[model samples]
Target: MSNTFPPVDGTWRNHYLLMRHGHSQANQEGRIISSPALGLTGFGLSPRGCTQLDTLLADWRWARPQRILHSDFLRTAETAERVAAHFDLTLTLEPRLRERHFGEFEGQSDDRYAEVWARDAKDPTHRQGGVEAVSEVAARMRAVIDELERHYHDETILLVSHGDPLQILLTALEGRELSLHREREPLAPASITSL
Candidate 1:
């Protein structure tokens, strides 16, 4: 993976924007909600999140997205919907963009994420607490881009997802060690990063 824009070798046919979903109810509650059973339907954005999207769209400075693809999770779906509505684009659900599964930590305090990430720094493949491995998350996240590259061209595509998966994807795209993903700057809720 090359960090340079346009990929330096013409590998990417589409401009990509990775946007993390806005602050969620789960975020306000400070709980881990990575299980599909919970994430798919519940924990949608908070009032602040809606305001964030409204403010962001009112400003609308990034490259206009031609397509919007997002995780089916409620928070992400809601986030994508806001952007799609703003740009008059439709949304396509992409399950691969779902939040990194937190396994046994599901429904626990969000503070437990630090423990999992610390383990990730030591062993990217370790599945402590049955959490999805960092390397696995990176691979799946990369596959999303690879699949998009195969079918799209000259289009700015918006990918709305959760924080950890996006961070892992960005780290992988930079050709960096997966174990160091947490060392990179954290992606703020409702923020967009171009790839």
Candidate 2:
């Protein structure tokens, strides 16, 4: 957070394009699918999701990426594949980019997210009901950027991940308290946030 990342090549010149995966079956069904097991096999892109990606790529307005990294979850993987194929870049599967684990809430209605967030608002590190701690997610997300900066410079890199993980990462990058994560604007499916 707060640009604390060590300078790379004498400056933080790299740009990271943070992309949320397009709407998935979970989005269509209004369910939460955060488990890596469930995400890997089910909850892939919905038909609308495919169209969203197609439209986005047809008129992409952001910096073209030199490298693509994405969570191994099916939805994110498919999203990254679409972009990578269009840009003629290889894809790297990064588990650290996986969605936040919702534990007992997996496959539940999306509304249940409110309950977790309510608790998160009070304690960012809470892991009740087996949920992953918010701080841990922030750390792994930060680690991805740290790793990228250490190896690359002056390049645009794309990272495809789920909504919550990306949001948490952004909040951390902004130097905001994790408890305030829910206060940020919700990320639209297939939307991009650059850093």
Candidate 3:
């Protein structure tokens, strides 16, 4: 009675479980701030976020995760903590799993950020303002996944991370480009996508 997300071509052999963080303060306020920038050591989850884990655990749909890797962000860590406790698994933090370095856009609202975001995509190597390109994030995540493929072929690994990077990685895995990311559907908070 397990659920299966058919791969791109309806093939099923390798399994990669990707999950977005649960609700967070920034998430509640609809902001793009990162935990490190704000000095929130644990990626503080909001009350709704805390309840997300409770709901997830109560549901039987969540697969018992084996190896756990998550972003160091407070939101991600908070979500991982709940999952780890429920499964008694150790959570691994990879800085590479952190959210896209928003650079100049770190604390800005959507309207304020959209202008630069448009230009940023044109040349993904834009790091002058401490910003990281979507390409670099994809490369890093791909590096991690490639290594994981070598070490855990045909095995399941859960990577709990932020929206942008996950979207980037998924695009690369499918041999697509980042522009397609915006066209991609939004991943729900605490939702899981199998690839």
Candidate 4:
């Protein structure tokens, strides 16, 4: 593993920007909505999330994105749309960027995430409570980049996803142990990290 931004591997072809979806209805309600059955349709951005996106677009500090790829989840889709509209670009729905599925914790109190993270620190592969394993999340998230590398080049791409998936992806890209993903700085709603 390399400590480089694009990974020392020759696979990277485009600049990457990782953006977590804006604060969502689920965040406002303090619930976990990881399942596609719910996330693909409901749990879109909250009023605060809309404000966050509006502010972020107004500031627009990072490189303008030539392409925008995002999770199909409603929250992420809405977030990507704002950026796409701001930049006058189109969006590509990337299911691989979806939230880390929390299985038994779906629709549960958001506080339950702490329990899963505690277990993730012990074993990245553990599926305790039926939540997606840290390694699995990292793999799928990386696969999104891998596929992008195969098809795009010399472009600034924005990847809009959920908190845990983006965290796991960044930790993997940084060549760190997946079990330590939670140790990375938390990604605020509508915040972007260059990769």
Q: Go through the candidates in order and give the C-alpha RMSD of each one to the true structure.
A: 2.4, 3.1, 3.3, 2.6
The number of clashing residue pairs in model 4 is 0
Write down the TM-score of every candidate: 0.95, 0.94, 0.84, 0.95
| Winner by lDDT | 4
TM-score of 4: 0.95
Q: Where does candidate 2 clash, by residue pair?
A: none
Count of clashes in candidate 1: 0
Return the lDDT, model 1, position 1.
15
The 10-residue segment with the lowest total lDDT in model 4: 1-10
lDDT of 3 by residue, 1-195 (tens): 122444444554457788888887877776767538572474368899788768877884755678889888888888888888888899898778888877776766645546545755576556656767778888898877767766765666788888778877777677666656555676778878776
* lDDT tens digits by residue: candidate 4, 82-101: 89998999889999999999
Q: How well is each residue in 144-171 modelled by candidate 1, as lDDT tens digits?
A: 8888888988999999999999989888
Model 2 scores what on Cα lDDT? Answer: 0.89
Error of 4 at 18 (Å): 0.3
- Regarding lDDT, does 1 or 4 come out ahead? 4
Clashing pairs in 3: 42-74, 43-74, 43-75
All candidates in order of lDDT, best leading = 4, 1, 2, 3
Report the lDDT of model 4 for residue 193: 89
